[model samples]
Structure formats: structure tokens, C-alpha cells
Target: MSSPATTPTAARTPRKAALASWIGSALEYYDFAVYGTAAALVLNHLFFPTETSPGAAILFAMGTVGVAYVVRPLGALVMGPLADRFGRKFVLMLTLFMIGGATFAVGCLPTYDQVGMLAPALLVLCRVVQGLSAAGEQASAISMSLEHADEDRRAYTTSWTLQGTQFGTLLATAVFIPFTLLPEEALFSWGWRVPFWLSAVVVVVAYLIRRHLEEPPAFQEARHEVPAGQPVSPLSVLLRHHRAAVARIAAAAMINTVNVVFTVWSLSFATSVVGLDRATMLWVSVLANAVALFVIPAVALLADRVGRKPVFLAGVLGPAVMMYPYLAAVHAGNWPLIFLFGAIMSGCLYSMANSIWPSFYAEMLPLPVRVTGLALGTQIGFAVSGGFAPVLASAVAGPAGDNWLGVAVFVTIACLISGGAALTATETAQKSLDEIDALHSSRTEAAELQALGTGQEPAAGRGAEEPAASGAGR
Candidate 1:
């Protein structure tokens, strides 16, 4: 019922939500990415005793990094329904507190020398907490932003949430550069803890910004439309009506593998195999992320004008093609080439997909199930893509190996799968947010009507076949 004039004003809600989403996502990923940086460069040395087989120790350390992702699906199942039923703001707040608290706890955990094997076990427990919080954070934030966005501008506005994530990555890498550069003795004992402890500052700032946000109006309307005591369940509705959307989202979600490989595995590859200093890889991460801050918003603007699918397709295809050259540069020990590859692949090419996904994924669902569908679908897909990317990348590198071709092949396949998924979705850029659910409802009703008139039974199987069907087409 929001008019075009009022719709513009309502869209301002996304801008507000974007601000909150940006800060919260920035803080959360800062904590998370810092851990990845450490896992790649330092954790094995600190947690595992110096041994002849340093590669195995590094692999074990990276496994710990992947452990958090193992908990993501559970977090999605628990928190997705909560966001759908309660409010986006509530879930956002809960995730921020959990991520921040757990990150801070990681800083305080005793090293292996102090606590023996118990130290790594405790580290994994805290990581699970971080994973659970993260599972719902991006989805909830995107839902909040997308629901508040105006139709034509949705991609641009929601892109800010993604921009925040890149900012977090940049901040995380920037923070770790100095720590990694510290004298080995200092870095081993206390310097690594500084980045984790810094989560306290990010958490405090994000909490204050998010506390003032209001729930999206679409959610408010959905609450009114559903019958009282009818046990409205977003998951149930999503499974029943939005199965195609879920599949599309999962396929599109595979693009995250590009990010995880670059962020986690590249760091390890560059430092361990390519013989680049750990500090150099961290600097590359910082620069790539800084570039992403601008590239993401620019690609998002282009998506709004040209349509989401084309922009998304370009993002997906660009990375697959670029993966070989990028990995090869690192293998050849070309610093300039390494920076160029990172900037283009991670910063510019991948940003095209990263920036637009908040709007693209949210648009695939109706207001009632938007949060649950986005969270569950993306998190489930990300479990395979992001969680195991490091392990896969390591496996490809093999024993006594720095196989850049193998890494490139792995990255290319993931990107192609994501592109194929994007091609299957309906174009939704021109439609209003509030009308999306209604439009979908009308389509469903019309399809049912046409089936009945053609002598086909309705799929739902309970309603009066004639009047309801006739009225639907009208």
C-alpha cells in the first residue's frame, strides 16, 4: 500500500539499515578475518610444537580455521527462524554480541605451551561460537537492508552491507600487518593477541549504531496479514513455495568459494609455498580489500541500471578466467604481478558479485520468508564453499607442492557453477519490495487457475477449484 512517493522515503530505511549493517558486518568480519590471517601465518607455530613436518602443522592450524564454518548451518537454522518470526534487529544484535564476545575470548585463550592440547580444544569451542553468530549476521543484515530498499535502488543500497564486509577484511589485514612484522619472540607470545582483543572496540561501536535501528515496514505488514495463532512459519512457507529460489541461491552462493580461496588459502600459499613474507600477503589483503570498498559500490550502481543478472554474470566469469594468471603470478614470486592479480580478482572482479548479492538474494523471496530463506540457503551453500576452501586449496597444493594450476582449476569450477545458477533466476530489479510478495501470490493464484481451466488439478488440493481460480486471474 506504500505509494511511489512514499516508497522513496521508505527506501531511506535501507540507508539506515545499511549504516547499521555496515558497522556490524565490519566488526564481525574484522574479528573473523584476523583469525584467518593468524591461522595462515602464525597459529601453527604457536599451538603445535616445532617439528620436521611443518606442512602438516600448518594444515592442522587451517583446519581449526575451518571449524567455525562447520557450525554455521546450525546457527542458520536457529537464528534464521528467529529473524523471520521476531525481527531483523533482534537477530542482528544477538549475533554481534556473540561474535564480539567470542572473538575477545579467543584473545585470552592460553597458548599450547601453557595449557597443552587443551588450548587448541578451547580455541575450537570459541570458533564454533563465532561461526554460529556469523551464520545469521549477513543474511539478517541483507534482509533488513533489502526490505527497506526502493525497487530500482535496492541493489545499490544493499551493496553497502557488502561494502562493510570488505572494509572489515581490510581492517583485519591492516591490523595484522604490524603484528606480523613484529620481532618473532614478541609476535609469538603477545602480538597476535592484540588483533583479537581489538574486537572489543569494534563491538562497542557496532552495538551502539545497531541499537537505534527500526524494523523494516514489510515485516510489519506481513505480521498483520497472517492470521492470529495460525502458527506462521517462515521456513515452512519458504520450503513450500520458494524451493526454486532456494536452489538458485545455493548455486549463486558458490561464488563465495572465490572469496574463501583468496582470503584464506592465498595467504598460506603466498607465505608458505611462494616464499613471500607473511607480512607481504597481509599487505596484499589490505590493498585488495581497500579497492573493493569502491569497486563494490560502483558495480552495484551498474547492477541497478543494467539488471542484476548481467552484472552478476560478469563478476562470476571474470574471476574464473583470471584465477590462472593470479595464482601463477604468486607462484613465480612476482610481487607486482601478485598485487595486480589480487586487486583485479578479489577487489574488482569479485566485488561485482559481492556487492549485488544482498539485493539479488533477498529479492528471490517474499517478505514472510525472506530472512529464513536467505540465511538457510546461503549458509548451507557457504558451508561447502567457504568452510572447506582452505582444505581443498591445501589438498591441491599436495605434499612437496605449490601447484598453482590445481588451485586455479578449483577456483574456476566454483565460479562457473555460480554463474550457471544466476542464469536460472527471474529478473526482479524493476519491481517494488512491498509488491514482491503480492506479485508472487498473484502469479501462484493465476497458475492454479489456468491449471484448473485446462482440466488439471490444483497442486495444493484443498480449495474450491472454480471461484478462487477465476478470481485469481482477474
Candidate 2:
């Protein structure tokens, strides 16, 4: 049995896991976000034949970008259960390879002018692979870190996973800024592909770091206790005992609309609609993400102290209120105002919720179902919010489209939905990893007892009864 003497060592393990998660996530998402940047500015021009309708072409390019999200949940269904049953480390390593290999291949694909329809088809295939990898990446990384974390500091540790994503976005945009400044003739031909090709370097580095990571203690305990052949199915476990948490996470994930709007829709809106220079918008994204790097960890620390809900609530609501002003500033065509808005909205305001989500979401479910619950819930919600955001933004701002107000309203509604979802979740800030599972178990049992009293069958296949008052702190 694990003992109290092991606590200090276990605490240090999460730090190492956090470091690994940060580096791996940074490398993985760099490949993903750079593709989005290229889709907005370069892919439409290169992958599709020139047509009379440039706007329609851009929309088509973005649709291809969104196609990845459609594949994400499918990937999650396969990988999530595997992560839960096998280990976080195994799934993470596989995800990195998939994303890295697909991204590198995309860099080398022939253009539409050369390969005809085959170019876009190849692009979609690579994107599906990337999406599959990404589907398991975030949840598995957070689970690895959070499961290793000292209970009191779980939010802080898991938040670093999110910080890594922002770092990746910042790094990708920073790399692209210099490339975007190249002459147009050069940019479309090869400049954009440089970022994709750089994935080779990121993949090698991430692979080296992730190879050494150990499985989390929670998973180890689950492995030992559960019978070898009677392993719990992640989907069945979630559907029976943790369905409410999954529902709440899915709803809260709609808050990703804020990200889609800021990253994808805004990139297109600024470049295509507002006539801002592509490099300028890229720089704005870089600064905002740079700010997020700091803000995410800091807010995560705050959540550790004050509670995840309040920090998350502020994060959820902040975007709703700020969207109008931010877009108005963008509409005014002032670079300084746009910079300030981007930094505050994405960097400071959104970072609050963004930072805490990795921990907050993981805490809601037990260890056995954690990866599946998170992957399925967040990806499904993200697909709805993120996949359609660019398309919706395009429709809202039709030809001669300058309606920033309508776009702002759309973003605010997404924020409100996520905020309400956050408010409905139980506060788990003070709970330890072991206690989280137990607490959920107890609450589940209580609900079942109430149902039994009313002559209803207790929820089927609920886990064996949790011992009462068996709490453990970080």
C-alpha cells in the first residue's frame, strides 16, 4: 500500500509531469494552430483554384479546418478508453506521433495547381489525423498531471497544461509573423509551409521528454484493485455514475466559442472583412497568447486558493461582457485598440477560465472515467462551438459584411451558456484525488438511496458503496 511517507515524492512527480505536459502540448498545438493561421491567409489561395469569389474560397478553406473537429470526438472515443485502461503516458506518446507526422506531411503536399483535387483531399486526410491526436491530448495530459498532483495544488499543476497550449499558439504565431512578412509571391509558394515543416523539430523534442514520464498514482491504484479481466468501461462508468459531470463539462465547453471567435473567426474577419494586414492580426494573436502564458498559471494559482468556480465564473462571464467593446475596437481600425482588446480578452480575462479548466474538469469525475469523460464531453461541445464558429461568422457577416455587432452578440451568447454550466458544478477545490472519486461515489449513492425510498430502481451498476467520512487532503 502507498503510505504517507510517499507524499513528498508523489508531489514532486506532478511537477515533472507538468513540465512534460507543458512541452508536449506546446509542440502538438503549434502544429495545429499554425494550420489555422495558414488556412485563413494562405491555404485558400494555394489549395483551391482561383475563382471570382475570394470570400467563398476563404470560407471553403476554413471549412476544411473545421473538419478536423468533426473527427476529434471519434478519435476521443477510441483513445479515451485506452488512456483510462492502459495509461496516460501511452496515449500521449501516440497522440504526439499522429499530430507530428500528419503536420509534417501537410508541409510537403502538392498544391491544387499541381495536383488538382488531390491536394485538398490529402489536406483533409492529414487534418483528420491531427484532430484524432488532439482529441486525446488535452484530457490525457491533464489527467497525467492532475493525478500526480498534491491534492491542494491540483488545479495549479493541471493549469500548466493549458498554459502550454497558449505557449504553443504564441510560438506558432511568432514563427509565422516573420514568414507572413515575405513577399506575397514567396509566401504562397513556400513561406507558409515552413511552419508546418518545423513540426519535425517539435515532434522530436516532445518525444524525448514524454518518453520518461511515469503513470499517475491514481491509475496505479485503480489497476491493482480492479480485476484483470473485469476492467470498467469508461463509457459505461461515465454514463452510470458520472453522467451529470459529463453533461456539465460539455455545456461549459461551449465557452470554447470564445477561443474559436478569437483565434479562427477573428483572424478571417480582420484580414478578409476589416482589411487589416495578416501580419498585424498574427502579431495581435502572438501578444495575446504571450499574455495568456502568464495569466493562465497565475489565475490557476488563484483558483487553488479561492476556489475554481469563482475564478472560472469570472472567466466565463468576462468574455461575454468584453466581446462588444473588443469588436468595436477592431471595427475602428486602430491597431493599438485592437492590441489592447486582444490582450485583455484572451490574455487576462479568458485566461482565468482557460487556466482552471484542465483541473476543474478532471476533478468532476473519478479516475477510471476521467479521460473518456473529459475527451468526449469537451470535444463534443468544442465541435459544436468551434467547428461552426468560423462558418457562422462568415454567414453573419455576409458579402459587404461589416456587422461586427451581430458577431459580438453571437460570442456573448456562447459565453453565457458556458457560465451557467460552470455555476452548476460542484466545487472540488479542496478535495484530494482519492477523495474526489469517493465524494462522487457517495453523492451518487445518496441519490440512489433517495430513489430506492421512492420505489425506483437504484441507478444500474453504480460502483460499490464508498466508505463514509474517508476524506484525504493533498
Candidate 3:
């Protein structure tokens, strides 16, 4: 099945794949995460009328932020299968351009004063495209990176994608902080649009970097393994065989709610409700994300040796305990306490789960359905929890004041859900590609498929006796 022309180029270099994944994710999320800051601070007034109460406007704006997540599952449905079938590099470039165009368009939209209801309508439409772009970005990037990695280093390699996320957040808030210091008149009028416009620059930078990357060898081998005129459908296979994986992943994915609460909702709460200075809240994002850029990679290295479950579970429980104090610090308007607690909760503890989930979730799936499975399961959970969290948090805090108790309880429950769900998965840190693939497919099936193309070793099956990674069989 190997064509002489393609074999040498088929397997991407792990370093190239990982670096491309990192920059691509950083650019996509820079576009994605900046919307949260805008929703909390700018969009409420520019897109929603002053006639709406401030709290209601904030809720409406946050709802627009959620709109992308609401439509994300739909995006996964469309984009996931394409990546699975067509190839990861194609979908990766496609989303890069799509999100770039959408983010730039957001900078061009007319405010409520200029265009009335049409402004928010246009904003939602742009968010929809962005939602679609994001749906495929992570799944494809993670799948590509994970496949390229050697077994011992997969968790560490894939985590660079999420490290890119921290960089994206850092850049978004870094751009936002200076704008917030502008005179209120200018800040509300033009200051806020600068970051949105800068998305175009990041887009060009990412596209130039990403276009040169190759598809992973395993995906190419898997594609070649199928018989002529009988190409397997990734979606059909996923729905029929991996429903349990989907469910487990969705539950584990709820950890995103903690992130949403910390990054978007908490920032809004501290500034709007507790009257903490806007600059101070932005610094929380800056510091936490800055810390995470370092912390996530370190945790990923640890997960590589010890296994993902313990690190992921620790990430879950740490935040469940810490959310209360973090919110309390915000309410007290104690700047030092807010800074300290925010760094601990979001920067350090949360980074552990954030880094590991890329490999933890990806390895559970077979090569054929991995991209689709990762995309759909995570997007569905995110649609319900993270998408709704900001709107729900604004509502729980009431129109006029802080409701730290209600908000804290909401985050804690989400953490517990993610932690409990993670326990159900088998630890995958030490497993090879074929061994991991055999966990879901029959051993004979895995070998027969691989033999048709790559001619690698037949799987010994997922049940083979061997030394277990820490927290295996939990």
C-alpha cells in the first residue's frame, strides 16, 4: 500500500508537528479567548442598549460568548469527520483561515448606536463561524501531535497545544490591559477594538507556519489500510462503537467550566460586582495564564512518568477546594489575596488537568475515530457547561451585587463531576499506539488493518500483562 513517492514524507517529524500544533492553538484561542474579555467589558454596552439593565446586558453579552459554544457541537459534527477522513493538515489550515476572517470581522462590526439590533445579530453570526473553526482546531491538532509522538513522550508533546492556550490568554489580556487605561470615552469608543484587529496579524503568522506541516504517519497508514471502494466512515464507526468513550470524555470535559468561571465569569464578577479595579482583574488573567504557560508543561512531564489520572484527579479536587477562597478574595477586594488565590487556582492546579487531557482523551480512541471522538465529546460537554457558565454566573450573582457562595458552589460541583468521570478511564501513559488501539478494537482487527499498510507489529491486545502506569485500573 505504500507509494514510493509518499512514504518518506508521510510521517511528520514530531518536533515539527508539536511546534505547529502549539502556534496554531495559540492563534485560534487568541481569537477565541479575547471574546470573553470583550463580553465582560465592552460588548454589553456597544451591542446591547443602555435601556437594558447593566446586569441583563452583561448576561446578554455573555450569552453571545456562549453562542459559539452552543454551536460548537454542531461544528464538531461537521469538521471532526472531515479531519478524520480527509487529513488533519487540511482541516487545520481551513479553521485557521475561517477563525482569522471571523475575528477580523468582529473588529469591523457597528455598535448598537450605529446599527441597532443588527450589530448583535452580526456578532452572533461571526461567533458561529468561530465556534465552527474551534470545534476542529483542537481535535485535529491533538490527534496530529499525539500520533507523531513516541509512546513515552505523547503526553508531554501534546501538552504544548494547551501551553499555546496559556500564551493566547496572556496575549489577549496583555492587549486588553493597556486599552482599559484609556479615558472612559475613548475606551468605550475605539480602545476595545484594537485586540480584535490584531487577530489578522496573528492569523497570517500562524498560516505561514502551519502550511508547511505534514500529516501524521499513522493516519496516513490507517487511510491506506482500507480496501479500495470501501473507505470507512469515522462518524459511523464512532457512533456505533465508541458511545461509552464519548460519554466518559464528556463528563471529564466538564473541567472546562472551572476554566470558564475563572477566566470569564470571575473577571466580570470581580470588576462589575465587587468593584475591584478592571486593571486588577485583567492582571489576574495575565498572571494566571503566565504561570500556566510554565506550569502546564511541567505537569504534562509528570503525567508522562506517573500517569494521567492521578494528576488529572488532583487538578480536579484542588480547584474544588480552592474556588471558594478565590471567589471570597475577590469579594473582599483584597488585591494581594485575589492575585495569590487566582494564581494558585487557575495557574497551577488547573494547569495539571489542562495539560494532560489532550493525551488522556486522545489515546482512549483508535486512530480512525480519534479526532471526531475528541472533538464531539469535549464540544458537547463544553457547550452545556462552559458555554452556559458565564451567563449563569452573571445571573446567580444577581443584578447588583456579588454572590460568591452561589458561584463557588457551581464551580465545585463541576470539578467533582470531572474528577469522578476521569476515574473510569484506563491509564494510557505507557501504552503504544497499537496497544491503545486494541483496547477499543479487537486485536485481530487492529493487526489486520495495520498489516494492510504499515506492516507494524500485531497488537498483543489491550489486556496483555505488563507493568501498569500509576493509577491504572482505578
What's each prediction's TM-score? 0.84, 0.86, 0.85
lDDT of 1 by residue, 20-129 (tens): 88988898789878998888778888776556788887888878888888888888888887887778989999999999999999889888789888888888888999
lDDT of 3 by residue, 1-474 (tens): 556455444654778888888988888788877888888888999998878488888888978887887888988988898997778999999998888899989989999999999999999999999999898998999998998887788999999999998788778867877888899899888888889999999888888877888788766655554244344466776786688899989999999988889977887787777777876687787888889999988999899999989999998999889999999988888889989999999899998899999999888788767889999998988887876777787788776747878988888888888988899999888888767776766433443233322323333563233332200110
Q: Is candidate 1 or candidate 3 better by lDDT?
A: 3
lDDT of each structure? 0.79, 0.80, 0.82
When 1 and 3 are scored with TM-score, the better candidate is: 3
**Candidate 2 positional error at 338, Å:** 2.8
Which sections of candidate 1 miss by over 4 Å? Answer: 1-12, 40-60, 111-118, 181-190, 224-227, 266-278, 390-403, 442-474
lDDT of 1 at 8: 28
Candidate 2 ranges with C-alpha deviation above 4 Å: 1-12, 45-60, 112-116, 180-191, 225-228, 266-278, 391-400, 442-474
Please give the RMSD to the true structure for each candidate, in Å.
5.7, 5.2, 5.5
Best by TM-score: 2
- Locate the minimum summed-lDDT window of 10 residues in model 2: 465-474
Task: Candidate 1: give its CA RMSD in angstroms.
Answer: 5.7
Best by lDDT: 3
